[model samples]
Target: MADLGHSSDDTSVDSREENSSQDSKPEFSEDEETLISRMYNLVGQRWSLIAGRIPGRTAEEIEKYWTSRYSTTTE
Candidate 1:
């Protein structure tokens, strides 16, 4: 039999706890909210070029921000 190196069962439990802790992080600040909103609006108008103009902004980040904003506004 080949020795397949496997992690202890505690690894899965530890990973789950770590993930839950990460999930409990607080929401973004107002400045982040504004930047995200700007990114989203720009994305809607110019899908290709806006990314280069905004530093540290990605399409996924823009989308997530927009979705969160939309959800909050609608509620």
Candidate 2:
């Protein structure tokens, strides 16, 4: 058999881990949502800056949230 980076079982385990961690992340407040929106618009998906502007959120979280909420698969 040809080598693949991960086995099917490994893929499934990774997917579950990702989903569980995502589920544990708290929802953004209305003000934080607004800030995210504004920062996104002003900087065009520059998530590090957006995360810097927000008090508690991490850049990775901000990037994921923006991608999930605003970006289409085509983009």
- Which candidate's TM-score is highest? 2
- Alpha-carbon RMSD to native, per candidate: 6.6, 9.2
Q: Give per-residue CA lDDT, model 2, range 1-36, as digits (tens).
A: 334645876898999878866773546888998999
Q: TM-scores across all candidates?
A: 0.37, 0.61
The stretch of ten residues in a row with the least summed lDDT in candidate 1 is: 1-10
On residues 1-75, what C-alpha lDDT tens digit does candidate 1 reach at each position?
Answer: 133334555677799867854552325667766765686565563523544555665555445545555755642
Compared with the true structure, the alpha-carbon lDDT of candidate 2 equals 0.79
Candidate 1 is scored at a TM of 0.37
Q: Look at candidate 2 and give me any clashing residue pairs.
A: none
